[model samples]
Target: MIGFHFSNYDPRQSGKSKFDQLLDLFTQLLTYTSGDVTEALQWLNELDKKYELTDDEYGMGDFIDELKEKGYITDDEQRGEIKITPKTEQSIRKRSLEEIFGKLKKTKTGDHQTYKPGLGDEVSPDTRPFQFGDMLEQIDFTESIRNAQINHGLDSFTMQEDDLQIRETDFKSQTSTVLMIDISHSMILYGEDRITPAKKVAMALSELITTKYPKDTLDIVVFGNDAWPVEIKDLPYLQVGPYHTNTVAGLELAMDILRRRKNPNKQIFMITDGKPTCLKIGKRYYKNSFGLDRKVTSR
Candidate 1:
């Protein structure tokens, strides 16, 4: 008989190479540094010094060279600048997608089905007598045949319109979503890094919509003293500013974006840590960061 053995697992013994491990940390640091490759690398170097991340055989220089050779970053000798490439941007998004949604159990691919029955691909269990306008494909032949047998004896063997049964299918709907991220000074306050997680969530959500639900639409809006749209590719470079939280502006922009979408299902997802402290009126701004202003909340 064959026997199996088990032993304690060591992370160092893990299959991932040094380059891959450093790349993961490097990508995460890039998000915090607003996609600045040089800054991210500098942070990585500092981390390596403290944590002994590299050994003599494989080091930071080797990791950097591999990054360039793998097309994740581009070097400009004249400007002496290192920048992340589009491939890196997409890689960050994919990594974020896995980090956020990896825990979810796998399921069949399909759109959200509504309770209301109509023409759809997913068949429902509910059935009713066939209507005049119902499509021929909607007819449940098994149920219809049973109905016919009950209505007419086997000797007679007659089928009628009254014996037909229609199986209703649930309606599947596509959604248009606007994600609003607050990039105010408050987000990075108290030595906590909130903006990085927000960027990760936005990137993950955008990737999920574009890849898994192609029919659905996603729009990203970043709000500071003002609100504006940002492309998916620009998410990694988003930064918070010395601005007050303008929740009203974010909502208005989100609604404006949703209006342009033809999909019937529309929604807004806002991520903010603080209350509304500012509002834009006419050409000026009304700001009261001390606390929640009644004037701002009323609006």
Candidate 2:
């Protein structure tokens, strides 16, 4: 017989090291600063001064050196500037993914299983009589053999088209998602800081699609007085602009992006804090922020 033993749990035994804790905080600050490495480090130092994030054994200087050694940041001597590397950008996305999705379990790629049965990689338990156009590989040999034995006898085994069993496979769909982000001044109004959360959600979703669902496509669009697409790598540096909301432009751009994608399933997700307040017509601007504008909303 097997036995089990249990021990007392200690919260202090958590696996994260001092550097990792600081790095997590630093990454979050970088998002708020729009990928400004110097500003993020300054904020970290301030937090350390107030909250005692580091001790004498492992100070902020040590963490900074570790960041350089790990290739997460690069310091240019000639230009007198410090910047985050692509590796750090990827790390921020991974952290955002984990924070929002809660550490997803590892699985095979393209695992979006659907109820509809068709040609797919994953086999389903449901089976049906073989159809005229069914492929030979889809036939369940075991069930077909059983059916043959039931139809005939063990003395002489024979199989017919009616005796064949076709196993159904779950259909996996690829999706083309257009994520529209509102960059109008309202996102940062009232000292609420709404754009940071929007940025995090975008980063998390982009990371999820790229890593877990490789076949899917994700396009990011930012809308203010106008709208345009941004690359996945530029998500960390997105900033809110001093412009009015032009949701129509964002939707039009999103639709244009989806039109170019070959995926069968398409969707649009918009993140905004205010209603439509601006519209453009033939080089002229129509703006109204008091309430919902009829012309803008109707458009």
Candidate 3:
């Protein structure tokens, strides 16, 4: 739980401070709840009473009304509930990702590669003989004029093969990568929680793939003793398990998921703090607390 501080202003107008107070309250609430404005306000009323709120003070109802008026939340009368607005949702996600991930690189993966001058793979932008539907701007004016004079006489003008110039497109393929994370107990060893940062990276990479490359694939995976996929909504509350690392299991699952894709270029990204210490054998468990088991490594 997070607490707030108030300046020693006159108590007569203390209710005015409710806006600032509510903002902090909501920020804290967002950490616990998934920015559920209505749910948070409902719980806030109890907190207000616990603090012995004054009658003149802005209550949860008033705060919720203001939130609607300000467009932070919207009330769906038919649904009889207040939900987060798109603006608020984006803000929360951006803030959370920034706080956890700090800054991350924009990754790209596609046929079109970003070209920089002097790079070894420098693509030739020179034009070739023009084809039908080629842009008129690409015409070699000098060559075209010379051809027109020689072919159709100087007074009459007509385009010919020598006048044509066609722009060339560069080609370079890249692999689309999907990163998987293991949210098992070892990640937060001795009370060092790592899930928050992991979630941030996933969100960052997802955003990067969608915005920067557009064609890239980024899938997030979290595994404990057993592995499974999850959505962005399932991230914040993700907790580590009292289970062993299952790196091979996670990789096998990832490979299975990526196999069906038609993309010739594809790869897997696995981030784990510890080695795979366990493997499922029949109905029993094979455990190796020792460092880097060969069988697990081979898998």
TM-scores, each model vs. reference:
0.85, 0.87, 0.61
* Between candidates 1 and 2, the TM-score winner: 2
Clashes of each: 0, 0, 0
Per-residue CA lDDT of model 1 for 1-299, tens digit only, reads 69988897544677888988898999999999999999999999998998888999998999999999999999888999999999999999999999999898878756777888988989899999988899999999999999999999788988899999999999877899999999999899999999999999999999988898888888999998999999999999999999999999999999999988888899999888879999999999999988778999999
List the candidate 1 regions with Cα displacement exceeding 4 Å: 1-9, 76-79, 105-110, 119-121, 129-139, 151-166
lDDT of 3 at 92: 52
The true-versus-predicted C-alpha distance at residue 52 of model 1, in Å, is: 3.6
Worst 10 residues of 1 by lDDT: 8-17
Candidate 2 lands at a TM-score of 0.87
Name the candidate, 2 or 3, with the larger TM-score value: 2
lDDT of model 2, residue 26? 93
For candidate 3, give the lDDT.
0.65
Clashes of 3: 0
Lowest summed-lDDT stretch of 10 residues in model 2?
A: 8-17
Q: Per-residue lDDT tens digits of candidate 2, residues 2-121?
A: 899889753226578999889999999999999999999999999889878888899999999999999999998898989999999998899898888886687665577888998798
